[model samples]
Target: MSPTHFISIPVASPGITENLRKFQDLCGEKIHPHKVQYPSKLHLTIGVLKLFSDEEVQQACNCLSEFSAKIPPILCEQPLHGTLKNLRVMRGDNQFVKVMYSEFILSDDSDRLQNLADKCLEFFVERGFMEYQYNTTAVKLHCTLINTRWNNAGPRTINASEILSDEFELQIFGNCVLDRIDLNEMRADKSFVAENDKRYLNVSCVSFK
Candidate 1:
């Protein structure tokens, strides 16, 4: 299902943005600027919710509020620190890549972050929020840096085989802290493209305790 809304953890550190901006700038014309992810939009999505009405949206918002109060136990009163891994392509060959993202591997190689995401999804699912389902066993958290679907001026896929160079090092964004989770409303078309209008709305947010 296409997501009308999603629950995500914001990767808002300045260093993270600066690193991404530098890499995007280096790519220049090789990658469509239209498809490149804006620094402000970077986030690690947990899962999407298909809320079709105002009441359903409210229900999801309430879930965030209640879920946060219980986060201290799941997280042990600490924020999640994610180490940014190297850039990777999704779903296909590297020559015809469509989705390029940086995986956020949690600190100490522990499953704390993944477990937290699972718990949050279970919390909402039990409340009848109608979480948008995916084919994978679980939603993988990653920060998308480029997606060809967002650009119309070029072909559907880019030849990314040649660009994985030393210029883009592993863990480019370094360690990132995630202290807040948010529920944001997507655009009417459910696209992340910020062409002429705001791509997402900040409906609700909860900081970890």
Candidate 2:
């Protein structure tokens, strides 16, 4: 069976990408450039689907399209403002840091975003596309800045406290408008630079109110 694909919303703001690029450059100076994420590929994942075949992927896409059509468009009162505050790592029960990402917080401190994510998960679960088990303790709305799955294989630890000292604590990546939700196929060969290209097909875009 093929690997499972993901459902997510792409962050298309150029300002956000440029700011993240600067952070990546800093990480390059401290760690390795390739270890950091390409700014262009920043996204907020909605849910993961256990799609192993082409037919399943198509069915998932159709499901998302129908699910989106019924709901009103997602809206933010003030152009969703987010801040890249701290650097954190995701650890499993074995205490292995599998993924590294930036902590994102909205200025409004609203639950609307989390509600949207829950809705996405609910839609997939009800349709038998995904399991009902909760992956994380809570649905943390975030943007993945770096993932070591492709770059590094061994278990490692990073001193986030030392690295985040001084002015690097909080970085405002600028505001973004949540206009569309795209169902994208996860591909191993895809990089941040190729995200804007036609290689990735948007199976469905959730309409906004």
Candidate 3:
């Protein structure tokens, strides 16, 4: 069977998205323009489920709905504020990087966010939706700012760390409200290029007390 691709939630907010767009613009000027990610597609991945079947995906969605209801609305009292700071690269030993991303600093109530992620992983693993052996401890909640996978402009060696120096100013991109969990798919071409509206098979929205 083919491997199924999906991203676990905590999608970005408009404020964060706007900042991501600005960063993309900056990359276009400073780094390779082709490396930037689409503003609308920017998201913080919680986890990924590989080699899932269509039925398994549906089952996972159902589980998400149940899990979402249990997660209290995160940082909803006031808009959840987070800062986009620092640039890092995920590199393979082959001398090429897999992804480039920005580290986010959640203002407060971060424990709530981490707990939610832990619960999601626990649910999936317990139900066999995700592999039991998969180490959930390693999951870092982050957003991918640049990916080389879909870049048609070809490869280029650029040190993101060098381009983004400590002197570079960081800003609070935006406020986020964790109201929903989205279930998305990866296409055969290994890209989530489908219209964002159509790509989500299910969106589990939270109902806060």
Best by lDDT: 1
Question: How do the residues 1-209 of candidate 3 rate in per-residue lDDT, one tens digit apiece?
Answer: 54365545554667776676676666555456556765555566666676446677667777777776566554344444556566777664324565777765667736666666666667766777665334435457776777766666756655555445666554345656544455566542334455332233333334333
The best candidate by TM-score is 1
List the pairs of residues colliding in candidate 1.
Answer: none
Off by over 4 Å in 2: 73-85, 92-98, 133-138, 152-157, 188-201
Better of 2 and 3 by TM-score: 2
**1-209, model 2: which lDDT tens digit per residue?**
54367777666567777777677666554445555566655677777666777888788888888887545544343345555555665655323344666655666777666667777777877888866545652356667765555556433444454454565634566566665567766664343345433234455566554
RMSD of each: 3.4, 4.0, 4.4
Task: Return the TM-score for each candidate structure.
Answer: 0.86, 0.76, 0.73
Query: Comparing 2 and 3 by lDDT, which wins?
Result: 2
User: How much lDDT does each candidate structure score?
Assistant: 0.77, 0.61, 0.58
Model 1 spans with C-alpha error above 4 angstroms = 131-137, 165-171, 188-199
Per-candidate clashes, comma-separated: 0, 2, 0
Poorest 10 consecutive residues by lDDT, candidate 1: 189-198
